[model samples]
Target chain A: MSIILDHVNYTYSSGTAYEIQALKDINIQIEDGQFIGIIGHTGSGKSTLIQHMNGLVKATSGAIYFNGQDIYDEDFDLRNLRTKVGLVFQYPEHQLFETTIFDDVSFGPKNQGLTKDEAGLRAFEALKMVGLDESLYYQSPFDLSGGQKRRVAIAGVLAMRPEMIILDEPTAGLDPKGRDEILDLISKMHDEKNITIVLVSHSMEDVAKYVQRIIVMNDGSVMFDDCPSEVFKHYKELEAAGLAAPQVTYLMHELKERGIDVDTEATTVEEAKRSILKALC
Target chain B: MLRDITLGQYYPADSVIHKLDPRVKLVGTLVYIVSLFLFKGPVGFLVITAFLALSIKLSKVPFLYMVKGLKAIMILMIITALFNLFLTPGETPIFTLGPLKMYPEGVKTAIFMLIRLSYLIVGTSVMTLTTTPNQLTDGLEKGLMPLSVIGVPVHAIAMMMSIALRFIPILIEETDLIMKAQMARGADFETGGIIKKAKNMVPLLVPLFVSAFRRADDLAMAMEARCYTGGKGRTKMKPLKYSGNDARAYLLTFVFLAVVIVLRIYNL
Candidate 1:
């Protein structure tokens, strides 16, 4: 029911002149129903790390276990693992291709060998779950708005009924409203479906608002893994890792430095407002 | 796996050949290809082989690395050899296979064709392996400068070539990303017949083309933002200059061409 990576290492173009060590000795454990945010600078191996979860990219060394089963075992079924651990890539709308939205959303369940009726039913449920209108089911996905197309892309993954869904920068290239709407939908999915959610993002504000825990990556290694309050407390180290705490955390720290008694660990604006009000009162 | 392709890949190194002017290397490759065709017999091959071996050695690229380029054209080489082996009419029949006869002169022609093709590839690989794409384009623009007098847009052609070369790696990486995204959605690209495989490619190609057009639009906008109005009166950051090493290279090329010409005259 949990995923564990033990001493994972990956190198791109190994043994060639272009060889690059993309991941180095990564070791982490992801528990069931946990909402985790993976934060890192570009090239810090966030994408490579997530890809290894479902065997999209094989590790040069070490192993990954899904609920006590070694995924890289000779007899392990990778396709089944992929069905269970759904991945929504960055700019996922770009991967959409179907004559109609319903078929596009059904692509995943149908690939799992579901009958047309079963797949269609799953697609219908997934579309509704993503908040898509029933009318758009018969329309071309290309004709939808960017945000709507992205919802369809995510619905495609949800139709598989995966226990865990990992999204890589899911809000990228979306408007601020679209970003909040998408994040809200993702949070609702985790709460209602009881699904494990791993969000890889560069936005500290979004992660601070929704994710229960944060994993900070630096130079292909995990630098921190803890609750949001504890992780944001290491703002200096995080900056060294090429990231910053949420802006409110910095503001709270500044208030404290100015001799006001405020908790610097407040990462969200609401938390900062409460802390600042308490200190003033 | 797609990244394994090393076409027009330059090997970074510091050596005599790398230091030589790119124009000289470009012309040297042309001369070498011409010399390969000029060979008439084993003696001429000896001369050509010696010249090619010397150039490759000076370039400092590993022999294995240079020869790896041959793998790409292996099918073409084999097809040419097979055509020569089965189609050439000769007096002596060496072997027979199911109504097809191999002749002695056919064997000779096949061997000659294989040698010529391999030597040409190796020689050209040496040139490209030593010269960076930027330097090669610069050399081409400079070499074709004379053509501008007759109304050829040499600068624009060179600029286009460099841009195309730059986009190759970007497009490859994009294609790999798009493929992985589709694969995650359970789009099985492999494990299908030819037609099914092509049909599967629709998911990959449509997005690739859209992104490519978007990228082109962005690049054009960025170029315009920088006030780039096509290569009119553009000056080089590092102008091409012939140095001592280039002079030596030219002298060596002169001798090699002379030897090849004399060998041709003697019909060797």
Candidate 2:
């Protein structure tokens, strides 16, 4: 119930004039029931990293082990691994193709060789899991609003009942309210299922608010892998790498500069508020 | 895996061939095709081969890269050669196989036709593999500028061509993403029966078409916002101009054609 990437390296367009080393000597272990956030700017290989988890992309050099089985072995069941590790891509709404929302969600379960009726049942549960209304089940997925469409796409992945779920920028191009709703839905899924959740994002605040541990990547290598509070302590280094700490982290730093004896590593609004109030007292 | 498609692929280089005006390369290719028809005997073929070898050397593109494009047409070349080997009537019979007899003329023509087809392909590759899509469309628009007077819409045609070329890589990238997304949904594209594989493509194609249409709509709106009127009285940011290299290239092309024509006249 875990995934390990051992000494992985990936090269895009290898041996060509336009070749690029996308990932270099990466090693990571993702254990069950851990909610982790992978934060990096675009082209920082975050997308490439997640694609490897589900056997969607093979590493040029190195091996990935899922649940203690080498994924690249001669007889490994990649399709079975795909069922266990669901990946929700960025702009997932674009992947919806079925005439009805329920059918589209059931696509994943059906692909896993479930009976049509069984798949439909799983799809129904997945739709409910994403908090979509029962009335919208039979409607065409294309007719749904943007947020609803995204929810259906996520349910498509969820119907497989994966042990782990990886979301790549699930909130991209969404309104602020939609973003909060999706993030909250993801957090709820993590809490209820106790699944290994890998949230790939570029926003510092989004990860800080939801994930327990943070993996900060810069130019294809991991810069920090620790708890959110500890990762934010290196705000200067993060800023130098073209990423910023959350706004509340900056607020705490300013308070500290003004001689307030507050903890500077508070990553969220609530933590920062408590630290500031305690310091004032 | 889809990257193997070398359709309209341009190989970047800093050689004289690459730096020449695209119009020059286009004309040079035309002249080379014409010369391929004028050659006669072994001497003519040798002359043509030497000229082609020199041009390839000066182009600085890898020989292996240029030849990779031949793989697609290899079957056609072999078929044509085989046909020539069996059917052509000649005074001398060189060999026989079962019910078929091979003539010396058949052998010569087969070898010649094979060489001609290969050279034709390699010659055109020199033009396309060197000229970028933008430059190619620019060359086409300018070369056919005379037709604009007859209401041929030359500029519009070139604009369509350039836009299509620009979208090729973009569409390829989008297809890659959509395919991966579908694959993650447990869609097995590989290891399926033909009918099953075709059915599996539904997920990939649907999303690709959706995104492409969305992108087209956005592009159209953006173009309208910028007041992009049709190409009447429009000026290019990078205008086409011939250089000393282009002049020499034209002269060399004419010389090659003249030599081939002279060889045909002498029957040598």
Go through the candidates in order and give the C-alpha RMSD of each one to the true structure.
Answer: 2.5, 2.5
**CA-lDDT, candidates in order:** 0.90, 0.90
Report clash pairs, candidate 1.
none
DockQ of each: 0.53, 0.74
TM-score of each: 0.92, 0.93
- Give the 10-residue window scoring lowest on summed lDDT in candidate 2 chain B: B1-10
- How much is the lDDT of residue A116 in candidate 1? 99
What docking class should model 1 receive? medium
Interface RMSD to the true structure, each candidate:
1.6, 1.1
What's the lDDT of the predicted structure labeled candidate 1? 0.90
Candidate 2 clash pair list = none
Q: Candidate 1, residues A173-266: lDDT per residue as tens digits?
A: 9999999989999999999999999999989999999999998888888889999999998999999888999999889989999999998888
